[model samples]
Target chain A: MTSGLDVRGITHRYGKKTALNDIGFSLDKGLFCALLGPNGAGKSTLFSILTRLFVPDAGEVMVDGHSLAREPGKALARIGVVFQQPTLDLDLTVRRNLKYFAALHGLAGKDADRRIETSLEQVNMAERAAEKVRALNGGHRRRMEIARALLHGPAVLLLDEPTVGLDAETRSSITGHVHNLASEQGLTVLWATHLVDEVRGSDHLVVLHRGKIHANGNAAEIAGDVSLQTRFLEMTGGGK
Target chain B: MKAALICLVAIVHREALRFVSQRGRFLAAIVRPLVWLIVFAAGFRAALGLSIQPPYQTYITYEIYIVPGLCGMIQLFSGMQSSLSLVYDREMGSMRLLLTSPIPRWWLLFCKLFASTAISIFQVYTFLAIAALTGIGFSPAGYLAILPALIVNGLMLGALGLLLSSTIRQLENFAGVMNFVIFPMFFLSTALYPLWKMAEASTILRDICAFNPFSHGVELIRFALYGQVDWMALLWVLLAFAIFLSGSLWGYDPSRSMVRRKA
Candidate 1:
């Protein structure tokens, strides 16, 4: 069986400085994987490579059995991404934003409307669908972005620092929502962040430090006797 | 194929909606041309003399002579405005969303060019209508004939804008583009003065104006507005469009340093 996402021997560099060094990982369907890394750990560069914004120097990415290099369109069709920065048009309403995204993915008319509605409901933003994005709070805007990402019903969702700048309560709520998406809806998720508390004990955790993976396994097992925070600090050189 | 069409429509529709929401932009697009037609043309009518050009069968007023040039000006500014927005979008991260779509990257960039061209064409027609209301009118058939010319010219200028946007790394640097590119291209072209007038002053300046692609765009519009065709101008504009579009495509390729540096 094909993994939901497979990164094999991926390497990337900017000039003489390597950004990602032989990084490799995989996730099965319906799994929530946390890619925990501190600042300058090359998380953004890896996301850029995965999203095809930058081509890797070596290796390949497989998304739901589709090779990113050989069949980019098919691979892209299966992957939805929410970048660390907000991508919504602040002047446009919530529904209009989702409709625009849906149309980009070839959804139109009744089908587009249905998906927009469903996605908004998933994020509990259906009631505010008519509101302009500029009128929403930071947490709500993040929710709207998540809704837009899911409008095309992508098989794998990749979020880079999704909960950054949100309140602790909002962050936990958003994280809980995404975990529910993986568990109940059978969606695959790779959530990248520096927050250790966001990783559940049972979740798959991949610790990336200085462009290399230091640990990848069940979160509890990786933590072992120590707390996840202490283990993460040790793996990443005591937070440098 | 259907998906591509849908994506194209969506992009164009979004551009139109954004254009409508920014009333200041629409007003600026119209007022700039109108100012040239009403004020500068009036001031220069006595100083400059226009002979019987191919597009002009007889002596014409300065306003009538400069109308096509002003149309080109509208498109030129509109194209640059579109480029400025592209730079802003890139900085704001919306461009990443567009580039990561399932559709081909070239197709996405083309869609953006098409949307910019469509918006410019609409602005040109609106400017033309305002000029007609001011008693500077073209042949009835010329109005209909100018549509195709406007589209081609708009696309050529829009492609140039796309090329510039792909190379421009930040929004703050766009002012440099205006001073270095927009002013020189507009002033050095056949927009305000005829090539013959430039020749009387200096042969070198005249040759430079004649060689400018924007001059060909204006001449193409001028002839098309009089129910005629300038085949040379048409060919030159098309060639420039091809070159600019190709450069923009290369600039936007993922492997290229232009985009990689940004990443």
Candidate 2:
């Protein structure tokens, strides 16, 4: 199947220290894929390169058949990013943050308004749209970010360590909501995290460690017999 | 096109509200120069003599001499302040949102420049109004003439700040800006003292002062205060604006990958 996000022999470094080494993976369009890695496995680095915040040292990134190098704007337009931190301007209300993002995507006017409303509704953030970001809890902020990311109707949604500080309930609900979006709306997702349970058996999973891909396949297939925790521990060489 | 403008307005409006919200910044913008104009200049006026220049039809008080310099100071600080905000915005991820937009990088940077210039102009006028209140007033026609100079000056200073923001990489770098950039530029120029006085002190310092972009910037404002033109000053200020703006754009290009590793 054609992939939504493709990486071929991607390598990145920070000075003498290597971060990602010949990493190769592809996520099919409309797939709920998990980029699972240990701490310092270069997940965030990968995310930065993907978001065009940092250019990769070596690699090719294609989003929906568009080459990132050749047409960065188009590639950027095709993907939505939800960074690990709560990036909303605390002084701005949820609606204002959403509106700012809409403008980024060249979306405005009545169409932007409709899309903003629709995206907020999807994350159930419409009711709190007028509330300043500082007033919202962690889960609510993440929801707001999700709503903002969706405003542009991107084909690929990239979440970097998205559920870092939320309760298990909220985490699962957010994961489930993202999963549903992938299936129902054909939104390809590259959900990067260290959290084991966030990935389901059906979801595509890539295990990264020491700046290398350890394995790539269905989560259940790799985690078979042993728990995901055990497999992940063995891969990172950090488990006692 | 319309959307960008709306975003620009919202951003600029937010900055204005932020200025209103933080009363200290306003106080600082006006008070520093006000102190210089009234107390310091009154003391200096008797000692140092200034001949009539192009803008000044006759000899004026030292209070009036540095009005444009103070205006330049306002532009300089507002520009640096905008850079500080850019760093904060990067940390907060708002810059990411703007950069990731489908718009060209230059347009986004220009939008930021426009927003900052607008804020700087507001600060300039506020400073002028305060100056007028202290009997350091300009003619109403002069005030009208100054608007364009304020914009050009604000833009050049803002561009310098943008260039610094792109190059500095972190908030700690601001200390370096103050010591290495702001202080040197302010002190080295004919802001507090006349260039002829610097010539009296030392020709090398005086020659350097004569060539300072800030010297040109101040001249641009000084002439505007008298409702006249300084084409040389205008050319130098515009040249500095072009250079700094180009440097900022070069530093911020995504392909450079500074944001990736730095952040």
Candidate 3:
């Protein structure tokens, strides 16, 4: 089967500064990958380009054979995005927020209702559908956004720093849940973060530093004979 | 097309509902204009000394002449209020949700202008009704006649807000845009006083008011309130609307990657 995401020879710049250079990667179906990077590593820039929030200066992004520039709507329909910041309308109810997303993805009527309920059930937020987003804790709010992202049944999920401000237990639980979704549901995942603990041995890891990919390999293999943290710092040129 | 329309409605509905939920906003919309109408206009009635414009057949009080200007004020402030909230929405991240939708960016920004115009028209009618209750009245035919004119002016001001929202960068800088936009647009326009009145003050000030698009907005309202169409002023408002709307679309282009840095 074809890969879920194909990014080739991607280069992006901001004025005189290069945010991403010669970045290329691909993910097959059902793979969970972490975009591990340090600050100023161009992770957000890549996400902006990938999500169609910004256009890259050069290169291409293909999702399930749909090119972003040629057919952005169709390509976007196949992918889901969760921004690092919470984007929910605090004044709106959780279900209302999810329904708003459903409409954006072109799901309506009975099909939309079913998907909304199912997606909320998956993220453990079904019961709080009536509550406004302001009432939910940070972890639950993030989970709500995750459920909203999945309402369209996207083939690939792109989460940018999903666990930025959560407690340890909640963070791990959310990570485990998304990992399970990728493994069991044949969902491809690209999770961006600065945290090292979120990466696992079996998962694919792309070490991004200063807008360039330093290393890309299986986590256990790349960090072999050393702590993943140490290997990461050393690769990014952050060694003491 | 269906998906795009739905996305537009969802974003527009979110704003409309927010306006409905804020009781203070509704009252503030009415009261702010009423204060100028009752307190300020009453005091300036004699000193302003208006001639009979097309809308005024004979010697008219400053309160009566300023009604169209006050209506223009309602649209102007509502436009700026919409702009202020756009800034707030960007800071809070909700604007990002609207921006990242896969539809063409111009369509989305236009949707915002259209929505803001609807809300502004609603407020103008309400202020008109309250004005009538207080013995400040318009010709009923004049009232019906001004509806389309109000919409045109509303879109012009809202497009301006959307444009300013794109370039202002941060909420901190929003005040600067307001100062540069709001004060000049109001003081230089016929909103508080007429162009002829400004001519008495200074020829430079009169020329500035004569050229202001907002002066045309007030003229459109004034003529409409007298049950006559001001096609010349209508053309100016439409032209301003097109320019501001186009500028906003260009400013927020994804190719610029403006939001990534602005946010």
Candidate 4:
């Protein structure tokens, strides 16, 4: 069976500086995978390749059984993304933003309205649908982005450091919400971040360090008696 | 086909909303042409008398002559502005969302060009209206006839803008590039003077003006404004549009773009 997301022998570089080297991982359906990496651990580069914004120098990306390089449209349609940076149109209202995204995915009219409503409600953002994005707080904006990503009902969702600047409360809530999405909606999630607290013992964890996968297993299996923080620091050597 | 049409409409709708909200941009587009019509044309009229050109049935005032060129100028600036917004969109992360969508990249880029063209047409009509109010009017038929010409010319310039946006790395670099593109394109084209009048001063400059695609674009609009067709001008503009469109498509290829290279 096709995994929700699979990356095999993926490699990328800028000149002689390797960003990602022979990185391989896979997530089954309904699994929440945390891609824990440091500042230069190729997290952004990996995200770029997965989204097809940047073609890898080598390797293949399979999204919901579709090969990204061969059938990008089919593969891309099966995934949703929430970028590390704010993608909202601050000048446009929340509903307009959702409608615009819906149209890009070939959804419109009543079908789009229904999806937008459901997605917004899922993120508890339905009440603020009429407000402009400029009026929203950072946490609310992040929630709206989550809602936007879920609008198309993709099998996999990728978020790149999604809660970077939010307050502590908002960060945990957003983390909890995405985890729930994986568990409840049977969606696969690949969340890229360095936050060790976000990963639970039972969750799938891929610890990337210095352009390599240092650990790939259940968080608890990898961490043993120590916390994920100490284990990650030891594996990455705290960056020479 | 239905989905493509919906995507096109949404892209155009977004462009329209942004245009409406940014009142300064609308003003700048009109005022630049208006200043040329009132101040520059008035000063240059006595100094540069025009003989009958093929597109012109009889000798005309400088204001009457530069009207089509001004329309082209508006489209040119609007096209560059659309490109500027693309750079901004990329910086702000909105472009990432657009690129990650399931639609073909070429289709999305074409929709952006079409949207920019639509806005350029709107600006062109507004300038034409103000020109009419100030007593420079085309044939009533000319107004309707110019729509196709405007679309063709708009796409040509918008495609050029797209090509530049894909190649140019930063927003800071855009203003300098715009100065390079906009001034040379405007001055060297038939926008200011007929080739014969230009030949009176320098054959080399006149030859350059004749070869400039933007000049052909201005000529295309000029003929259309008189309810006539300039087939040669149409052909040149269409060929340039095709070249720029293809260049933009290639420039935006994931492998070629700097965004990809940096990754």
TM-score of each: 0.98, 0.96, 0.96, 0.98
DockQ for each model: 0.79, 0.58, 0.61, 0.80
Candidate 2: list runs displaced more than 4 Å: B2-7
- In the range A1-240, model 2's lDDT, one tens digit per residue, is 668999988898888899999999988889999999877789988888888776788998999888888898788889898989778878878887787778766676799889988998999877898988889999999988988888888999999999999999999999999999999999999999988889898999999887899999999999989998888888888643
Task: Give residue A88's lDDT in candidate 1 (0 to 100).
Answer: 94
| Residue-by-residue lDDT tens digits, candidate 4, A1-240 | 779999999999888999999999999999999999989899999999999998899999999999999999999999999999999999999999999999999889999999999999998889999999999999999999999998988999999999899889999999999999999999999999988998989899999988899999999999999888899989988655
True contacts kept of each: 0.77, 0.59, 0.55, 0.74
What local lDDT score does residue B147 receive in model 1, on the 0 to 100 scale? Answer: 87
Residue lDDT tens for model 2, B40-105: 888988988889867678888888888888888888888888898888878777788777776677
lDDT of 4 at A9: 96
- Candidate with the larger TM-score of 1 and 2: 1
- lDDT (C-alpha, whole model) for all candidates: 0.92, 0.85, 0.86, 0.93
In model 3 chain B, which range of ten residues has the least summed lDDT?
Answer: B254-263
For model 1 chain A, give the 10-residue run with minimal summed lDDT.
A98-107
Better of 3 and 4 by TM-score: 4
Candidate 2 docking category?
Answer: medium
Model 4, position A183, has a per-residue lDDT of 98
lDDT for B246 (candidate 4): 95
Model 2: lDDT to the true structure = 0.85
Error of 2 at A25 (Å): 1.6
